[model samples]
Target: MRGVFLLLGLVGLCNASVLTVNDEIHMRSKRSSESEMTRIRNMSPSDRPNCQPGVTPPKIQVDTTERLSDLRNRFTAAGIHGYLVPSEDAHQSEYPSNYDLRREFISGMSGSAGRAVVLQNKAALWADGRYFLQAEDELDCHWILMKLGEEGVPTVTEWIEANLMDGQSFGVNTYLIKNVEWDEMSKDLAKKGITLKGVTPDLIDQIWTSGRPDQPNSPINALPLKYSGKSWQDKINNMHVAMAEKEADIMIVTGLDETAWLFNLRASDIDYNPFFLSYAIVNRAANTTILYIKSATSKLTASPTDAATTETVQQHLNTGASGSCSGRTGMCVTVKEYSNQQLQNDISSAVSTTTGYVWVSFGCSRAVYSSITAERVIQDNTPIALQKAQKNTVEQQGMRNSHIRDAVALIKFMAKLEKEVKEGKHWTEVKAAADLKKHRMAVKDNRGLSFSTIAGSGSNGAVIHYFPTNDTDKDITTSDMLLLDSGGQYLDGTTDVTRTFHFGTPTAYEKECYTRVLMGHVDFADVVIVGGTFGREIDSIARRPLWDVGLQYRHGTGHGIGMYLSVHEGPGRISLSHSSFISDEPLNEFQFFSDEPGYYEDGQFGIRLENIVMVKKATTKYQFPGTTFLTFETVTMVPYEPHLIVKELLSQQEVNWINAYHKTVQDTIGPLLADDALAASWLSARTKHMTLENETGSGNQQTAFLSLVAFAFVTHFIL
Candidate 1:
C-alpha cells in the first residue's frame, strides 16, 4: 500500500497494435543526468541522501497466534483445509511491494524471500539459508521454520502433499499465485484428491485493513526517449512484430520492467526500484492500449496518450521535443485507477476483437488471466525480459557513464571507510552502509540505491544478503574481511558491485582465500564463450579454485543486472543453482551480468569481489569454424585491496587482469576526485599496482602511512 505498484500490475484493454519508428533522440537523457548531477553537486551531502544513518527501526509486533486463528476461520468459511501465503506480488518478482508482503504480515518473518503455510492446527514458515538466522529470531514460537535448500528439507509442495489428508482442500490467493506455480500446485494437489482453491479477500489483508499504508499518489511519467534509446512506439513495434510471429492477438506485459520499458515510464512506487505499480495491455492489431493507474496531480501527467475520455487522466504528452508516449500510429493508451468492475468490462471489450486468445506471460498470476474474457489464455514464452537485458548502443554507453560516476562515489565510501579505520576510529556496519548511500546520493541522476546496502563485517559477511542492523553492528577494524556489496540506481543505468577489503595485514588463510576468489573472479569473467554456453558452465569456472581449497559459498556465482531497473534482472545469469529459472539464451552483446566469486568461513572472514560486466565481442586472433565467442568487459570501477592478495598464487593472466582493472579504476576515479583532495589521495594509494613485494610487505604503522599517501601532490591538484 506504500504505492500503487505499476511495475507489474496491469489492467489492460488493448485494441491490437503495431508501430513505425520515429526520429532518434541523442543524449537528452545525458543532458538530464548532467542536470541532475549539477543539482546534487550544488547541494550538500546531507541534503541529498535518502537513507540516514540511525538506529534501525524497531520491529513491528504482530500477533501470529491471533493472525493464524483468524486465517483458519477464513479458511473454514471458504471451505478450505489449509492456505498458502507467499512473499510475492501479482508478478512473481523477487522483491514485492510492501502491500504484497502478506507472508511477513502473517508470520512475523521479515526476509525479502519467504513463504508461510497455515492449517487449522499447524503452521510453518519456509526461509532459505540467507534468511535462516534472521528468520529464527524474527518468527514467533508457533511457526515451524523450514530451512529451504538444506539437506532433507522438503519443498513446500512436497510437505503439503505429505501433510494434507486425502480429499482435503488447499487455498491460496489466486492474485498472488503465479500462473505456472498454480498449474504445478493444482496438478500436484489434484493427484492427491485435494482441491486447490483460489481464495481472496485475503485473511491477512482483512486482519489489518485499517493499519495498512495507503498507496502513494505519484504520477507515472515519460522516461524521456534519450535515456531509453527507443521510443515506446519502437518498443511496441518490436513487441507487435514478435506478436505477429507468434500469431498472438495481444501480449500482456505483467512484469514491471516489461511495462516500464514498453511505455518508457518510470516512477518510485517501490523503494529503490524506480517504478510505479500499474498493469498495461498493448494491442498487436490496433494502436490501442489501456493502463490501470492513478491520476496525475503532480508534475507528471496522468495520461500522455493521443486522447482519452476519462476525467481521471490529467496529463498529456507535448509531442514536440520530448520523447513523449504518443509518437506513432496515434496510440491512445487509457489510464485509470484500480477498479474491478471497470477492468473486467474494458478487458472483455478488448478480447472481443481477438479471435484466438489473450496473450499473457507465463509468469503472470492466474487471477490476471482469469479476469480476461478471452476464449482461452495462451502463455507467451518469448517475453520482454530478453529484449530489456540486451542493451542498445545508447543504453550500453549510458551504463558506462553511470558506473563511472558510481565508481567515484564507491571509492569515496571505501576511502572514507579506510581513513576512519586507519585513524583508529570505530565504524559500525550500518554506518558504513549509510556512508555508501550518502556517497551514491551525491552522484548525478541517482534516484536511490538499487537495493539495501550490504556492509557485512566479520561473521555477518558469512550470511549472504545480510541487511546490517544496529543490533548486529560490528565495529569495522583494520584486519577484518568486510564484504561490501552495494549498487546505485541512476537514470542512465543500474550498477551493482562488491569488494572485500582489509585495512591491516591479513591472515595467511584470508590472503589465500581472497587471492583464490580473485583468481576465480578474473578467470570466470575472462572466460571465452566456448561450446554449449550456459550459466552453470561459466559458474564452475568461478567455483573451481575454492573447490580445490575445499571451500565454497552457499550462493550463486553471478546474476543478471538491469539498466536502471531491478538490480537483479534476468533472462540470463551465471549461477550453479537455479540456472534453469533464467532463460537459456546465448549470452549476447551488451547483456550485463555480475562476475562475483566469494568465500565465506563461519565466524572468521568473508571475501567476495564482484563487478558488473557485459558480454561483448572478444578480439579473436585465432578462430575455429562455427565459433563466435564473447568475453566479459568489467564495467564496475573500484580498486581492489592489495594487502590481501596472495601474489604467488595468481597466474600471470589473473595478475594482469587485476592490474589492468586497477589502472582503469585509478584512471576513472582519479579525475572524479581531482576536485576533492582527501578522497583523491585515498584512492590513489588504494589502487597502486599489485605486486609480490607489496603483498609480502611487513605490517608496520610507518609503512602503512607512507603507502596511504602514495600520491599527495597529485591528489591536491586538478587532473
Candidate 2:
C-alpha cells in the first residue's frame, strides 16, 4: 500500500510542474518507497538553487563605502568611539539569514557569519573560512577583511582593547548581543580601562532605509498528545511543580522555541526556527494561560475516535466544541481580545497578591521588550536557563542515538564524494554541500539541517567562518583540501561536526596548522575544570597552544550547543571573557558547548576541529585531597582525517586523546551501520591500528611521560 502511494506521489509530482499542497502530499507519499524515493533523493541539492545565484537581495547589497563613513560619523556624534554592528533580523534572532542584512548593508560582506567594527578612523569586517572569497568580492577593499580565528583579526573584545584609547567609550546595540556575550564584553573592556556603552543608534536603519516585510501570522496545526508524549494539563502541572521549587508563583515563557515545545505546535513564521509569536504563563498553583493570535481552528480534543465517527456526529461535535473553550474562568486568552493594557494590569495584579519570585524561560522577547529596566526579565530568566540546560536521562539518550545516525549519514556522504572526486569528476562546493543535505534528509525522523553546511575547499577554507554563495563557487580538484562543517536535527537530538581532509597531499603549512588545531581540540577535551564559569578566565586552556605560535581564530573558542532548538543555545559558553551582554545571569547547568579551535591562513587554507561537549558534574573524590573535577561527554562521532595529521607534532597525551575519541566513536556507531555502508572501503580503512607508540625521549623522561604512554596503550587497544 505504501509503495503504491509513493508511486502515485512520484507520478503526480513529475506532472504537477509547480509546488503546492498537492505536491507536498505527493512528496510525502513517496517517502515510504525506499528504492523509488532514492532516485529523486539522489538529485543534488546544490543544483536545485534553494537560493538564487549572483542575484544579491537588495537588503544584502552595499551601495557605497559612504555607508561606513556615515556610521563612523554617527558614532562620533553620539559620543561613542566605536559601534558594534551585528547581523540580525528585526526579531533580534540568532539566525542571521532571517534578519535584516545589516553587515552587508554597511560593509558588503555577504557571508552569514560576519561582524563590522565601525571606528572613527577605520572600518573592519571579520568573517570565517566560508566567506573569505565572497566577503572580499562584496566588501569594500578599504575595509580590513580579517580572517576570523587569526591573531590579527582580533575578537570584538580584542578590537576594543587595541582601538579604544584611554577614556574612549565603545557602544554596542544591547539587543544584538545575547546577555552572556554582553557581560563578557563589558567586563573585558572594563579591565582594559575602556568603558562599554549601550547607546541606541538609529543610523543603521536610517542608511539602509528599509524594514523587513511583515510576516503574516499563519495557522498552526498542533500535534496529537500521543506524538507529543504528554498532555497540556500534565505539562502545565510539571511546570507548576518547578515554579514552586523555585519559589516563584508565576512562570513566564518568553522564548518562542520553548513556547512551541510546551504547546506542541509548529509555525512557519521563521525558517529553520519553528516558533510562533506567543506568550505563556503558568502559576505555582497549576493555573496556566497563553496569549497568541487565533490562527487556526482549535482541534485540542480531536482524537482517532472522532475520525472514525459518523459524518453527522463529527459535524455536530465540531460545531458545539468551537464556542465552548473560550476565555472561561481559567482559560488561555486570545491575544486580540486581551489587549496589552489588560495583560499588563493582570500581571501587575497577580504580582501584588504574592511576594513570590517570577520564573521566565529562555529568550523571553516579549517580557524583555515590556520591561522598563534592563535586569527585570534577565534576572528572572537565569534560573530557568540553568534548568533547561541540564538534560534529562531521556534527552541524553536521544542525543547519543541521534549522533550515531548522523555520523553514519555523514560517512556515507563522504564516501560518495570521494568516489566522485577521485573519478576526475568536477564537483562544486555547492554540489558537495547539497549531497550532504540529501543524505541527511534520507534519515528517518530527521528534520532539516540544524544549520547551513559549510563546504569550503582550498583557499576558500581560509575564511574562518565561511558561508557559501553561487558566485564564490570553487571546483573540487583532487589536490585541494576540503573543510566540511555541518550538522542535522533528529526528533531526538542535534548534531554538529567538522572534518578537515586533504583530497590529496597537503603542504607542510597545512599539516602544521591542522596539528595545532587538533592539539587544542585535544587539550580542551581533557580539561577537568569544576565550578568554573565559562568566561571566568578559563578560555586560555584552548588557546594556549595557538597563542604560543602567535595564532588564533577571531571567533569564540566554543559556544553553547542546543538540544533540538537553537544551534547556539546558551546560559553556558566557553569564551575568553567572563562578562556577557546581560549581567548577573547564572550559567545553565549541564548545557552543551562546542569545543572548536582553528587556525586560518588567508588566501591559503583554513583549519578547524569542532566537537560537541556536554558538561557533567563529578563527585569529589578524596583520594588525593582538595581535588575537584568535572567531565565532558563527547557527542560528535565523525572521525578526524588521520592522513593529514602530523602525529609527531602532537604530545603523547594528545595522541592518546585522539585514539580514545576515535575508539568511542567506533564503539557507539559501529553496530548501527548497514552491511553495505559498514563494508565500504573507507570504513574498513578507518579501522587500522592508530600509531600509539613513538620514540622515547633520549635525554630525560618524567612520570607524566610514562603515564601518557600507559594511557595511549590502554585506550588504543581497549575498544
Q: Largest TM-score belongs to which candidate?
A: 1
Candidate 2: where is the Cα deviation over 4 Å?
A: 1-61, 64-86, 89-91, 96-107, 111-137, 141-247, 264-268, 283-286, 293-380, 532-537, 580-590, 617-628, 675-679, 695-719
Q: Write the per-residue lDDT of candidate 1 for residues 2-30, one digit (tens) a residue.
A: 12212101111000000000000000112
lDDT of 2 by residue, 389-444 (tens): 56656667677778888888998888778777888888988998898899998986
Q: Which ten residues in a row have the lowest lDDT in candidate 1?
A: 14-23
Predict model 1's lDDT versus the native.
Answer: 0.67
Residue 388 lDDT in candidate 1:
90
lDDT of each: 0.67, 0.58
